[model samples]
Target chain A: ELKVEQNPLFLSMQEGKNYTIYCNYSTTSDRLYWYRQDPGKSLESLFVLLSNGAVKQEGRLMASLDTKARLSTLHITAAVHDLSATYFCAVVNNNDMRFGAGTRLTVKP
Target chain B: EAGVAQSPRYKIIEKRQSVAFWCNPISGHATLYWYQQILGQGPKLLIQFQNNGVVDDSQLPKDRFSAERLKGVDSTLKIQPAKLEDSAVYLCASSLDWGLTVGELFFGEGSRLTVL
Candidate 1:
């Protein structure tokens, strides 16, 4: 079984602050994905990290993967109120993908 | 392009009742997946289908939950004798098969079920 663990499941940060959410998996994976979801909404893809040392950034959000360590991170730079939502990191191995518990971020303005 | 489509945005029923949800994947997508997401948790894969054939259903609760994709296009999920723990969001996603590569999945708004 593949297990994914996320740290600091609930985070409340002030606007303009920086924070990082960590995702660690128990087994080796070929790809990792970051997704965001607002209350009552479906997931929105944030980034797809396919290789070790892979990093992708968009606006205030950035994601990176380290396959050797079986870890991934989602970093929020200068967070804004609109970025408040639940973030999830999913690890994919072969044909299966397992998701982390998720990090609920609340950006207070 | 339009994303995956799901119907009955919300459903409320008593325990032991039966309910069904529908989904329509993106045009030309050959793979579809159903997931269960409880409140405050990440989505858990229930079943997956590739062009009308089930590819994986190991996590599905076979005794009460069933799903099928017909003609490789639309899909439906049915749950009978629902339990309170089954109250959650049912999400539908679709992706293009690229043989061995993990493709990005497009998700629907999801159907929220509440069992009282």
Candidate 2:
């Protein structure tokens, strides 16, 4: 079974601060994805890291994948109130896709 | 292009009652997925279909849950004799190709189920 673990499940950060949400999985796979969901809304795809050392960024968020370590990270730079939402990382292994427990972020001004 | 569409955004039912949710995937999408998301957790894949054929359904609770995709276009998920633990959001997703290699998924606003 593939297991995904995310750190800092609930985060409260000041606006303009920087933080990283970590996703660790127990499988060897090259495909990983990041998604964001607002309260009572559907998931919005953020980034798809397909290779080791692959990094993708959009706005204040950057995501990277390290396949050898079975780890991925979503970095938030200079967060804003609008970035407050739940973020999730999903990994695909052997045709099975597993998602980590989401990281809920709250930005305060 | 239209995104994945789901009906009955919210549903409230008594335990042991039956309920069904519907989904219409993006046009030309060959892969469809159904996920169950509980509060404070990530979405869990319950079943996946590839062009009207089931690809995976290992995680679905077979005794009380059933799903089908007809004509490789629309899908429906039905739950019979629901329990309180079954109260969660049911999400529908679709992709252009085989899901394993393509990680990008278009998701619908999930149907929230509440069992009383």
Candidate 3:
């Protein structure tokens, strides 16, 4: 059984603050994905990290993968109210993808 | 090109009733997936299809659930004798290929099912 655990399941931060969400998996996998989902909406792909030390950034969000440690992180810099949502990290192995429980972020204005 | 498409944005039915959801993947996509997501949880893969063939249905409940991708295009998922626990969102996603290296999935808005 592949287990993916996320830290700080609930986060409350003010606008313009910086925070990081961590995802740790129990197995070895080379592919990791980050997604954002608003209340009542489906998931929106945020980043796909394909290799160890692979980092990708879009706007104020940055994601990095460390395959050796079986971990991934999504860093939010200078957050805004619009950035508030539930974030999830999924690790894939041979087409079997397991997702973390998720981190619910509340960005206050 | 349009994104993945799903029908019946929401549905409500009683226990023991049957319901079906539909999905149309992005054009030319060879891999399609169906996932069940309960509130506050990540999507769980129910079934996957590569063209007209089934790739993985290990997580699917065959006794009550059935899905098919005909003509290697649009697909449908059916649940007979639905149970209260079946109330959740059913999402449809599609990828260009099966290999993780070559594919990134695009998801539909999802069909929300409510069972009484």
Candidate 4:
């Protein structure tokens, strides 16, 4: 079975601070994804990292994948209150994708 | 382009009652997926389909949860004799089957269920 584990299951950060959320998987996989979900809302795609050393960034969020190590990371630069949400990292195993338990983030002013 | 569409945004029912959710994928997407998400947890895949054909359903509880995609476009998920633990959001997503981008999915708003 493929399991994805995320560190810092809950995080509270001050505005303008920086943090990184780590996602580690048990199996080898080349495709990983980052998604964000707000209270009572469906998930929104953040980034899709398809290869080793793949890195993608948008606004204050940057995601990278290291396929060999079976790990991925979502880094938030200068966090903002609006950035508060639950973040999840998923790995594609065959035709199925398994997601981490998720990291709940709260950005305080 | 319009994103994936789902209906009955919210539903509340008593245990042992049945419920159903529907979804329509984005125009031209060839793959569809259904997932169950509990509060404060990540979405869990229940089933996956590639153009009306079942591709994988390893995690689905075949006893009560059932889903089908008709005509390779619209899909429906049904849970019979629902249990209290079945309370969760049912999310539908679709992906463009262009070989290179097999895993990038477009998601719908999701249907939230409350089993009382």
Highest-scoring model, DockQ:
2
In candidate 2, which residue ranges exceed 4 Å CA deviation?
A: none
Residues A11-109, candidate 4: write the lDDT tens digits: 999999999999999988758989998888878999988889999999999999888888899999999999999999988876558889999999999
Residues B21-78 of candidate 4 have per-residue lDDT tens digits of 9999999998999999998788999998989899888889999999999899999999
Sort every candidate by DockQ, greatest first.
2, 3, 1, 4
Candidate 3 runs further than 4 Å off: none
lDDT tens digits by residue: candidate 1, A1-109 = 8899998799999999999999999998978899999988999999989999999999999899989899898999999999999999988887788989999999998
Per residue, candidate 2 scores C-alpha lDDT tens digits across B1-116 of: 89999999999999999999999999999999999999999999999999999999999999999999989999999999999999999999999988567637899999999999
TM-score of chain A of 2: 0.98
Q: Between 1 and 2, whose lDDT is larger?
A: 2
For model 3, the chain A TM-score is 0.98
- Highest lDDT: which candidate? 2
Q: What docking tier does model 3 reach?
A: medium
Residue pairs whose backbone atoms clash in candidate 2:
none
Clashes of each: 0, 0, 0, 0
Output the number of the TM-score-best candidate: 2
lDDT of 2 by residue, A1-87 (tens): 899999989999999999999999997985999999999999999998999999999999999999989999999999999999999
The 10-residue segment with the lowest total lDDT in model 4 chain A = A90-99
Q: Which regions of candidate 1 are displaced past 4 Å?
A: B98-102
